[model samples]
Target chain A: MEQELISKKELLELTKISYGQLYRWKRKNLIPEEWFIRKSTYTGQETFFPKERILDRIEKIKNMKGDVSLDELANMLSPNLTELVRKREDLIKLNIISKSTLEFYTEERGKDKELNFEKILYLSILDNLFDSGKINFDEGKLILTFLDEYYPKFKGKNCELLFLRKLGISSCCLVSKPNEINFENSMKVVEKLNISDLIEELKIKLV
Target chain B: MEKNMMNLEIKGSGSSEGGKYNTVVIKGNGKIDGNLDCNYLEVQGHCEVNGNVKSESVKVNGNNSIKGDLEADEIEIHGEVNVDGNLSVEKIHTHGMISVNGNCNAESFTMEGAFKIRGLLNAGELELKLHGPSEAREIGGEKIMVKRNGRVKFTRIRKLIMPFGFDTGLTTDIIEGDEIYLEYTNAKVVRGNDIELGSGCNIKLIEYQNEFKQHEEAEVVTYKKIRKT
Candidate 1:
């Protein structure tokens, strides 16, 4: 979990974003309902947010809102399109999942295997990371296994895939609760990305 | 055949509930429910809102309580305001007391009164000559200025009933911006491009890109000026 909690007052002062915008975003579903985070303070009940996440989200919203409408922004933040199934050709046409990864996926899971949206997202993420020179092909396979095993467990939460490489060995972990994207002492972070942001990026590219 | 209603007035204990209008004026103790989207809103007597208030301009003279968020181009508060949600405006000139449970965002915030905000206070130009103690958890902007009136005294009697119980000094955590000017403030970290700290500021860290100047009386524990990357 992101541990640092910032009071709503502090958030507003720091961002200078008004309460109306925050609540409007809440109403529009641009921010996760769980992030509202009500806590008891000396002065009755006050709202708090996971500082890092909210700050990143608000910055994203501010930057993207000028280009898109509020409803579209809400759609971008909305999650759980994981079960939507797409054909292999459609996924390639959508320019999300690469052909090489799709070939590899079909080879392992069988050509006729019906992959859901989450599996496709994982494959797309792996393909993109490898193509961008962030992760090796073998490390990508580890990330795929990690995602296939653990990504589905997180229903509505935003999770990230982290590939840690150390001493000529690499391992991947799914972080449902991320803190600082730690690389430890000597571990190299191969590639890390929040799944929802990947989905949004794909959506933007599709649009 | 038609009424050119450019303004609206509620007088003599009259009350109305929610609608859209061009301009709204409440002279008597009035109440409104639902969304109030108008061009201008002025409250001279006690007024209460049960929903959001959006207008081009808002001027509050008497006590007003908003159950929902408030948004406007310009909001001038000379009396008292109690808001249960966020407050977004272009320019806010507050001379009395205002309490917002949510964030306060504006292009420019000019305050000479007691203000309590539960959320961030972000703006372009934040100028304040605080009448009483005011507080926000985080304060950031392009050009930030906060100075406590020299004549004001931090008496024990005044500290007893203040809204947030903030002492006469302004207290905050991280204050980062491009140009920051502070006086009589206590902050954990102050980072900016051009920072000039006035007297009586207690800042733990001052990370600047270009210039950093502190008054002789201001106390800054750590400060660094780094080259722009």
Candidate 2:
């Protein structure tokens, strides 16, 4: 049996991928490098790729789709995936827990608590999220969910509750109450809460 | 004569009487002191005109020179031309070298070879080719193009010059609503919203004055170390 040569257009159509994706895969070494053949023409010499190698590589990528990301797939077949997924997952989990914990502790501490354990936990979660690339400011509200389940007595404090709500945290109060509050008023509440101090504390603990 | 097919030829040293014609092809060396209003005029030999050359289209092939101003819908010069006065045309294509002492205002202008201008060069669409190596002290136009091995020089005075802004420097500068390509022979300082620098250009300085900073990554190659004087 003889192998057939395929054009880049044909290969892309068969693989159901864009030209950019195909080129990116080629760059990462996920696909087999193509062989170029020169053909002489009236104007100049044109170069073309061999079709067999491209088809074979496309088949391999189709088989590896479920097991790896495109970047990982690039290395697993030829070069090196470098264990990026495991490291990334670990970092993400660490950040989520650290930020959530800090928000929990801040709400738990009152006006004169010597040690704010809740703030510390929240900061730690933020640090973990930062490391994991999941450090969304909205995730700071997740602490309230954990607190509502854990501590029921801290609910009626408008300052602390509104502060969390303003930070885009999901809260039972926000869902129940519908009011048109401007950013200026929300910022005033934020200022009164002195979240900057908490943020400073977070920076010291997390960094 | 048919309105669509009107051919008027002047032989020997004769004068072209001012009249609107379809096609006027001057084969020999002739002179026209008055305005020439025609659809198309082709001059093969040397032609010295004293007045404005007005036509729908004009083509000068031989060593032709115009001492007076020119007004036409379209003008093409295939040979060397020395215009001592201003030239106003809709479209112009000069295959040979062109030297203009005064201003050149046109909608579209193209020079295949070298182009030299002593005064201001203004056009809605201007394309120039500095074939070997040329220089211009002060030049201004709407759209400009300098092929490979072309040089442009502009003297900087006390003035705020802005290139293009927001939009990429792909299109020419617009006045009210018109695309004009402004090409320089050597240097250019623009103060506009959008500006684009074509490839294969060696520029001294490019300054941008805007609130937002747009970063573009490009290959930087340092050739020599300089000392402040």
Candidate 3:
């Protein structure tokens, strides 16, 4: 999908953030380097950003500025999943994972000793899919096992989790970000989740 | 792992393997064959590292080259240093010259001679006393000050030896900062809150929010004051 683009000049005007704050955020790694798209204009070289994403990010940063330090903010927004461990009891207490789902996850993957960030994320994804009453228990287990085996390979990289159904038979696929795939008419896309966004969401929820 | 937990000292023409060390001192021609992780790295002569250099503090008084990225808390350069990849440091103080083929990120950067960065130079507080031709693709900082130091005492001998005269200016495509004071800088666009175009600056377009000052010798094609909002 084509995203709306906004120039750096217009963004600063709309956001009311000075150049200093913008660069400072960039230096602090709160703003990812890939977002600063350099394009040549009639006048000269100009910087542009994905309109919706950047605006939302700036809004979130502004809201969380006074409460947390920029370094903490950077960690929260960073694409790389930081090393975090959450107990299964805490996950249940926080209502992040349904009890049934947690029970199923532990049954398939042995006992839950200490759920790391990646494990929790995978559980949450499975729970989200299962809670919607779309996928069955078998498919959920498939996802859990698939993620457990393959997710580490994509660490610190942007990836997508795709759920597709062909004539009521569901299968999942994982691909790196900025990818385009065409499905046949018989295939239906059940759900597509950007792993990076999920990571950000899980990070915020954990915080 | 415990076999090489020691300091490395190369006095004359020698080569050593790179690894974790408490301190690495090279006084003469030395070569490091692998990645180096050290607490303190002091080079007084010519040295080449084939891999990345990670140190808490790096002091270079002579020529040194690194084929990979450099990460250090503090980097002090008194002679010349060259990096084939990116440079990330907390503080950088240079009285001679340094060049990087990739982006440079620093918290505080102070320079007296010159620098050439193939990519963006991003710093929190950037101060440059230009003594020779310096260039970067783009520059972004909080407070940036660029001034020309006449005569170029440190580089005078090199200048006299060369038949052609060098331009004592900073050339960048774009410069963005909070408060910028520039001299002898040629940039296509300059955007900041309070900008001062010192003598011998050639800017194509300038966008400022609060205040904009231009010297008589500076040539600015166009300028506009941004809205307060």
Q: What is the lDDT of candidate 3?
A: 0.91
List lDDT for all candidates, in order.
Answer: 0.77, 0.48, 0.91
> What lDDT score goes with residue A103 in model 1?
84
RMSD, every candidate, angstroms: 11.4, 27.1, 3.0
Pick by lDDT: 2 or 3, better one: 3
Instruction: Report per-candidate DockQ.
Output: 0.04, 0.01, 0.74
Off by over 4 Å in 2: A1-207, B1-8, B12-23, B135-137, B149-185, B188-205, B208-229
> Least lDDT summed over 10 consecutive residues: which range in candidate 3 chain B?
B150-159
Candidate with the greatest DockQ versus the true structure: 3
Across residues A1-207, which tens digit of lDDT does each residue of candidate 2 receive? Answer: 134666543454466654334434543445543343444543223334567656765776777677668755543453211222222223235453343444444554442333333433334434544445443444445544554454334322111223333455333222111123445455333211222223333332232
Q: Write the per-residue lDDT of candidate 1 for residues B125-186, one digit (tens) a residue.
A: 78888677777876667778888764555544565766555556687776766778898788
Candidate 3 residue pairs in backbone clash:
none
Docking class of 3: medium
By TM-score rank, best first, the candidates go 3, 1, 2
**B143-216: candidate 2 lDDT, tens digit per residue:** 44444323334212111242331111111111110121123323432211233434433333232222111123
Candidate 1 residues A1-207, lDDT tens each? Answer: 337999876786677665446655664668786787877665334678999989988888998988999877887677656336767777788778788888877766678646666677778787878788877666767777777777768756677767778998888777774345555688987777777777767656544
lDDT of 3 by residue, A25-84 (tens): 988888888789999998688999999989999999999999999999998998688788
Q: Who is ahead in lDDT, 1 or 3?
A: 3
Query: Candidate 2's C-alpha lDDT?
Result: 0.48
User: Which candidate gets the maximum TM-score versus the true structure?
Assistant: 3
TM-score, structure 2 vs. true:
0.37
